[model samples]
Target: MRTIVAQDVVSASKFNRFHLLVFLWCFYAIGFDGFDIAMYGVGLPWMMEEWNLSALQAGAVGSYSLFGMMVGALVLAPVADKFGRKNVIIICMFLFSAFTLAAGLSPNITMFTIMRFIAAIGMGGLMPNCISLMTEYSPKKQRALLVGAIYIGYALGGILASLIGMYLVPQTDWRVLYYIGAIPLLTIPFFIKQFPESLSYYLARQQVGKVVEILNKVKPDGNFSEKDDYQLHTALKDGKGFPVKKLFTNKRAFTTIAFWIAIFCTMMMAYGLNTWLPKIMQSSGFSLTSSLSFNIMLCVGQIAGTLIGGYLAGKIGYRKVLVSLYLMGVVTFIALSITTNVALVYFLIFLGGASTVGAMNLGNPYITEFYPREIRATGMGYAQAIGRIGSILAPTLIAMLLVTGIDPKMAFATFAVPSILAVLGYLLVQEKYGSFDKVVEENGMNEEFIEGENKRIIQS
Candidate 1:
């Protein structure tokens, strides 16, 4: 009888054609998500002009999308567990693309806000689900780099948003940007045909026929048949039960809380800057075109930061790299407030983008390391959902500060507040708690459980 070790498959991870496909689809999916979310920020100035919106109303429009993202991350992301990741991706794609297309037709801010909020609900699940699925497909040693690599999609998506805004908004209407969001709706059918299901999900269901098929693609050993038995590491098994309880199980309570707090703080910075930086730059005396152009630098910085941070994490560690990014944020934000040199201002915004969105992107893979496949999306979703509260608050709060005639320097400095808070929260994360080996060792989950044929899946 043939026996396959699931842990061994992941441990001796190798990249092949399968991994490349996963990477491309995930990158495209997330890039689409990025485009959808950032379009609001990119088009915000024109929308404000068209609607004659006050600072408060403009800020409220940004928050509407975030509010929907909160719901998707909090409520919809966990559905990936039951329905499967590929299915959820398709549903999310349709919701966002169709509604974003509908949004372009809205005649007023109220309707635009409603359509954006629903589209964002689709946007919310994309990150957690994509991050979770990618983590599953990546090799253990290369996990950080590959996971971090896919996140460049968010920056790429944002970059596309800015480019489209620059060319289209000035020539036509801001609503035209929303029309572009519907482009993804065409790819939903393609995803179903090409995207693979989670290997762990197949194993959990004891669908040995399907598991053998997918596993062979990832790690092809031609001698497999339905008669063979396979077992997963006890620690890796997606145990059945309430997933949230598992977040705190086996000495993880403190670390889970720390992740939520840090996510909350970091997201406030990431979404706040993405939504408002262009407007703030325009307010600081740059022309509208120039302000929009700066957003491309911001996204470029995110791509650069993730690659740099991923490399640094390999040298130092994920936790340390995250802290360094936050410290960088503290200084860059302050510098941005006082700088008048256009070149220097662009550089500062570059740093701001890296420290803000880059940190959030880096944090996802780190957070997923703690959970089994069954609940990876759930943990990520909840963390982002809690983080979404801060996001939901950011635009309005920044708008409130702007309307009060606060010094531009002080308004910029406020972003630094959450950066510091994120640093402190991550400082408190006990890395040992995230270690699967530690959990296995502490609970005394035995070799027999890891070796027996589908033992954990059956017992659970």
Candidate 2:
């Protein structure tokens, strides 16, 4: 595992065939991840129409999926730590893909909802592990950039969903779309064989020989500066026992709770807005095209925002940047709710997308920073799993409000409170321990902690 961790510093130019292949595999995983995420969003309208579901029922469907995702995030993340990231990835992909494909074959609303719920579990579980895996193998200098790039696959998938809706939905049924989305699963088998085990995981377990073997496969030419001097250590800092328990007991407990709150709030706002934007717009006297295009505008903004946020995160501290970004989301969401002008709405959408989307990206990296390597995945999973609660509840809450005849603008505007609150949460995070890279610094406390444990920390 130390050897795998040692290989973490390879220059981009040194990334040979195996690197390229792994990047593509991760990319493909992300693409499919995107597809599955958007599937319910795209199908919601049609499903509502066919089943004569009220706004509340439609919202419930979304909530169900989010609830399932929360379960997966909470449950699978720690399992990844206890088991292995690669195995978790494979199992999750299978679970999600199979359920998603089955969603296409559902004979009734109940059955369809069940399938979506199951698939959401797979969707939630895969994200952190993928982020962790990619980061584990990527070069250190390019860690943020690579993570950002991997996230682009998610945006690309959203765009693909929009494109499919634009071109295919009018001509074909939504079920066909589900079938097309499921097609990406074919890559899972390929990845299982080809995807490398996280070296950091091996090293943490003191399996030095296995780490060396895996490193050799990635660098056949033997160019990595394999040195015993380059000791690998876990970034975890809590007590030596089960890391999950330490999350609440250690110095990081306060910060961890803060992050989870921020995640919950932001996700509630994000999912709520994404789910209800069209309805809100229609209430504001917009046509279907204009309302639908609102989402496209948001996606464009998300892509642009992620890029800008990634750059800023590199320049400033991750904590500072994330706080500012969440604040931006708070302000923009309120602006979006009040603005009547289409152009201003689009502008706010872009800016909000930029800031809030980046906040979403911060979860994995932030988790990587907060916990030691020994329990990194566990920490991330717990955060994400808990965070999924906000996402799961958003839709149902919004639906209930809509049923109550709450003003559309006012309904969505309520979400802005959370974004602002998230800024507060981020500020509470200790700047000294707010980034994963801090653990990599010379003579850092995390290093000492890892040495005592004699384990390698895997980060992605």
Candidate 3:
């Protein structure tokens, strides 16, 4: 009987067309999420003016969507582990695309905020699952670089939103952007037909046939077939039990909490800029055009930072890179707050984007690598869901500071505080807690694997 090791096959496989196809799936979906996020920021100044909204009211409107994103991250993303990643991704895309279009047609601020909240649920759910999917498929050697590459799609989406907003929001209306968001709905059916399911998800369910099918595609030369006998001693054991509780097992609790804190700060920085930077730039005495230009620069810097972070992470380590990024955020935000020169301001904003959203893009792959395959999606979800609290708060807090007649410089400086905390959070994480670490805390060395009664984390 032919035997297949699901974990071995995937990790040892070479990158090919199949891998690139998977990248496209994740990249395009995440790009749409980024585009929707930028829409709100681009539309915010106009939305407030159109509705005669106070600063507090506009902040509340922004929080509504973040609230939805938090709910979806906490609730929907984990469902992918059960129902399958591909299914959940398709559901999220449908809802996100449909509701975004609905938001544009909204007759009042009340209706618009409600629609945005619903659409954002999809965006929130989609982000973590895509990260999980991409991480699972990536060869361990190139994982960080591939994850970083997909995020370029996210940055490009932001650039697309900014460019469209620069022209359309001023010429016709912000609604035009939302109309374009619905375009994803048309492509969902095609993805459903072509997208592949998670190999481990099938293995966990004891569906060897599906596992064989996926392995065949991932490495077509392997000649995998349903007829092959499989020995998934790891999957059968690890797959049992609730994925969430298992996160605390093997003395992983502290590292889990540290990741949560770090991600929370990352989101706080990322969403703060995505939602409020343009307005912050305007309030700092820049023109409307230049303010929007600053946001574009922020996205451009993200692409640069993500690629650099990925490369540096491979050479040094992500933990060090992450801390450095946070420190960069601290310095750039402080400098940006005080700088008056156009060239200097742009440079600071670029670094701020790198340290903020760019750092966030890299953080996901880092977290996923630490987690075992069975709980990868759940692990990423909890971090982002908890982190969403910071994301949810940033818009309102920035708005409150703006309304309080505080110095715009001081308001910008507040972001520096979280970056400082994030530095500490990343530092506290124990490297031994990582899934791939051979010397784990559980045994002070890798625990011996004994299937059935004695199995632990399945080696991914």
Candidate 4:
């Protein structure tokens, strides 16, 4: 009997109900992740008024969630690789849902901040795991597009939160937003019932039985049996040990570091804008409802960007698409700094969201292709963890700058720096590693390309 590699089965299978279920479930989970993360900003105006918070104090409160996300990404995401992606996702979902509800009930800034931080831990862990699971299940040709599709949930979540703030916040209170945020808890039971474990994860563990079980569902026609042997088409070693060390080894050091830089820069801009865009617009004389509507427009642009970026990535390739997006981000931010017309400002905000948030979403599929199954979640986790450091600084830095009397226009222009740096970081990444179809055809998986490319880099 011939050896059956799990990925080949997945790659060759037609899109089926199993794939749709997995995609929809991940989409639902990440939507809530976006909602929880963006809620702080949506409610910040109200919180500031209700609590008499200084700009710095409000920014600090937002930073707590980013800090928690950093810790969660660094500490908890790697555990998914060790245990299972499905399990980590479930735990993360429960944590964020329950704590977001708790956050709404807080009587003081300290307690509210603490609850937000705790909720963020779950949000952080949930995102990368969803990306990893989606990546593993998707066919090579559709991987980036599928991952991007799942990420549309994030933008949708942001839009939903902004809409709630616009219609409900004025009628009720800021706490009502948090109450709506808790609705994700209901999906946990559905996830427990429906979510499938990553076939690659099981294959990495040499769990032949489980791999067979999943492959059957993934491609019911495969009719996989325990009598068949299995293999993964990657060059990385598999063993019973921590995979974090592997990120720095196998000539991955530079690629990993460069990837982290791109992640950090992109995330800084993303969190910074998401956390402050509404407030910044309000300061510019927009009504509170109108400012929140700007957030909705921003998220709507993110949805457009993710879909368009995914399509372009599939056509032009990931590196070119990402580089172009970051470059466009530079232009959009600069334009946003100077634009005065309300219609133009909204259009600029939409473009800025597309470039920043859309580019950030693109990073997941791009990075997913770089690492092997053994460390995919870990590599993504560490990259996101480092990025969270930027996320942590973004809102606070913007707040401090405004509080110190810097013009909001100049503050917006400052965003151009990270956009420029992100371009550089993307440039530094080995393009051969990112060419999904070519690598998949030539080496069966991109990790083999990374391993071989690293060898040449070391030798030269």
- lDDT: which candidate is best? 3
Q: After best superposition, candidate 2 residue 50: deviation in angstroms?
A: 0.3
lDDT of 1 by residue, 176-235 (tens): 888888988988888888888876667767777877777677767535567766764442
Write out the backbone clash pairs for model 2: 1-203, 74-385, 135-460, 204-456, 235-372, 235-373, 236-372, 236-373, 305-354
The RMSD of every model to the true structure, in order and in angstroms, is 4.5, 4.6, 4.3, 4.4
Model 2 lDDT at residue 137: 66
Lowest-sum lDDT 10-residue window in model 3: 437-446
The whole-model lDDT of each prediction reads: 0.81, 0.69, 0.84, 0.83
**Residue 156 Cα positional deviation in candidate 3, in Å, after optimal superposition:** 1.0
Across 147-232, the per-residue lDDT of candidate 2 in tens digits comes to: 66677777677667766765677688778767876765787777777788776566656666766666666656544333433354
Tell me model 3's lDDT, rounded to 2 decimals.
0.84
Q: How many residue pairs collide in each prediction? A: 0, 9, 0, 0
Candidate 3 vs candidate 4, lDDT winner:
3
Runs of candidate 2 exceeding 4 Å displacement: 1-20, 204-209, 216-240, 433-435, 438-460
Name the TM-score of candidate 4. 0.93
Give the runs in model 4 whose Cα sits over 4 Å from its true position.
Answer: 232-237, 433-460
